[model samples]
Target: MVENRPWMTFFTHVVLILGIALLAFPIWVAFVASTHTLQTLLNPPTPLLPGGEFFENYYRALTEGAKAVGAPVWSMMVNSLVMALGISFGKIAISLTAAFAIVYFRFPLRKFFFWLIFITLMLPVEVRILPTYEVVADLGMLDTYPGLIVPLIASATATFLFRQFFMTIPDELVEAARVDGAGPLRFFKDILFPMSRTSIAALFVILFIYGWNQYLWPLLITTDESMYTMLIGINRMLASGDSQAEWQVIMATTMLAMLPPVAVVVLMQKMFVKGMTETEK
Candidate 1:
């Protein structure tokens, strides 16, 4: 039996509180900054408590955006959301089907194909970005949603993970599906897909955040203000040339940009943990 000691328990709680405070203090400061005016924020010691300008600052950020960022924060947020969702779902779909093909099909050079896909893990987007940009530009996908998402969607890591998980699925299950008159696609849809829900949830959270925070690729491809992501907008806000940066509006936009990814993680926390820790479906 495990014995609980009072001193140990007290120490644990103290550590936990301290860690929470350490992490949350910066976010609190940002929130406080967002609530104050630029002049107020610039003067002397920053306020720890929120100011009365919260609504004004946020409303302006949402509708008017910052002086440097041409697109409204809401439109940029929508673009980010679309890109994130498209990349997440697209990556998962392609990975799932590709893994299924590698695992179930008896095609020639099957192992070679799997290895070929696995090898792509070494070549990240940064490595081939030049050629990729060239292709996108030639196809007239620049400044478009397809340009933002298509080049980033094929995930070697996801495919490898799914393949490993599929390998763990018993051969008996496949035999049984065949005996039950289930075709390959039917078995994948009805059985494999449902069982991989936790994995999908985990990958969704990660890929959503990845797509949302994309900077270099989006910067290179999107010259148009209408297609700017939140990160791009924030960068533009900061680099507004000789004009003083609007601290309140910038902070407000930063806080707004954090919400969708935070919401995704919060809602999928349980599934994400399960997917990461649990191997067996």
Candidate 2:
């Protein structure tokens, strides 16, 4: 056992190092590119390290194309934030209500309702995109915030996750609450909600990332430049045929677009891990 321990340690280090490189490479590349000038980035061969023109590139990206549909990266960022937050909050609320109903209430066809939602998990958004777009259009939500938010509000995954987590809580706790004359609403508010904080945090991180990185749906729903999300804005920036595309600007905008999801992950890393582990338990 003592002799074998050294081999195990060596293999563990090798695996960890490889994992770190796999995770860090893209982030390092993005950071380095964000600092390069357009000329440097677009040169015959791009340099691998940070360049001196980071602030200049960021400034030009923000101020250069004022009249363009997705110009002023800040506006696009704000639009993305509003849309992401709306979808995250709305999805969580809906999921919580649905999960609670399924878990705590005895009603007809409850299992059927859950099965229907589970079916949605098997279906990709792409498969339903055309019909969903038609619904949005008919509702007069096209090119609007409602169009962007409403389609994402019904997250079957969140509901399923919450239901599974809620199920793990001991029935005795809920029974104790009821025995004390606490109603269902009071039990949920005082006991269930507080107990599920870690799971909720995990779900929030997942949902926020989903909303932030969404591309195709937002692109299809929003035609108005003012309402464009950051992903759409970045795509539009890339598509523009100008004298020369600003690689630095593109990278900077990309980095800015990534910040919120990164922040969410960093801030909630502990809660996210705890939530996943606890739910499994």
Candidate 3:
């Protein structure tokens, strides 16, 4: 039994409410700015409430896109979707395969090989951007879907996660499969892969967000405006060099950019939570 501290409970509730408001304030301001016209937004002290131009602003943003840089919000969304899915699935596939090989196999220098992969965690993409760029250029993958998707696919974090999970599986499962005349590939496909669904779902949410929010790598590789991601496209919407910025359209694009990631988190939340709890335990 616990003591009833009504004042403490009330204080905790107040703090939580304040924290929620603080976090939600940015999205609120963005939504408000999105509904108003450029002239209205440019005026000092922007409106606290939504405006009537909601449909008009979103309609124009969706169809026409920003004044010049973007082709269409829909097209950019398609591009972002492709990139995000590609990165998520690509990383998961390669990482799973690599983890299986490392965890299940006995080979010469196995620890060395594992250590080599682990070392990559210390070196981020930013650190190797120059070398990675040169290699991509050599492979003629620049300005292509392969360019945007491939470079970001090989993830040390994903490998580490999958490897740790694979290690946790009972060796009896592998022994039983061996006794039943099941080879490694068959065992992985029928047993291990199916068992990993929740973990994969959790990883998907993480990788999808990472892929969607990628700005630097994509900006470096994609020279074509058509390949610009929603993040890049959003940045382009801002008029630079003393010109009055398009606050309304930029805010709308910001909101649109947030939708996919937020939706992914909301939809996969249960699976994500379950997987994380199981993984931790």
Writing each residue's lDDT as its tens digit, candidate 2 over 166-248 gives 98999999889989999999998999999878778877777778788888899898888878788888888777676465667
Which candidate comes out best when scored by lDDT?
1
Minimum summed lDDT over a 10-residue window in model 3 is located at 272-281
Could you give candidate 1's per-residue lDDT for residues 1-281 as a string of tens digits?
A: 16979898899899999999999898899999999989999896998899999999999999999998778999999999999899989999999999999889999998898888868878887888899889999999999999999988877888877888899899999999999999999999999999887678777777777788888899889989999998888989999899999999999999999888788777888765664464323
Clashes of each: 0, 0, 0
Clash pairs detected, candidate 1:
none
For candidate 3, lDDT tens digit of each residue in 1-281?
A: 17899998999899999999999999999999999999998887999999999999899888878775657788788889999999999999999999999999998888897788778878878898899899999999988999999888877778888888898899999999999999999999999999988789888877888889999888888878788889888877774446666788888989999998898778888866764564445
- The TM-score measured for candidate 2 stands at 0.86
Compute each candidate's TM-score over C-alphas: 0.91, 0.86, 0.92
Q: Report lDDT per candidate.
A: 0.88, 0.81, 0.87
Error at 219, model 2, angstroms: 1.2
For model 3, the superposed segments whose C-alpha errors exceed 4 Å read 239-242, 273-281
Model 1 / residue 57 / CA error / Å: 1.0
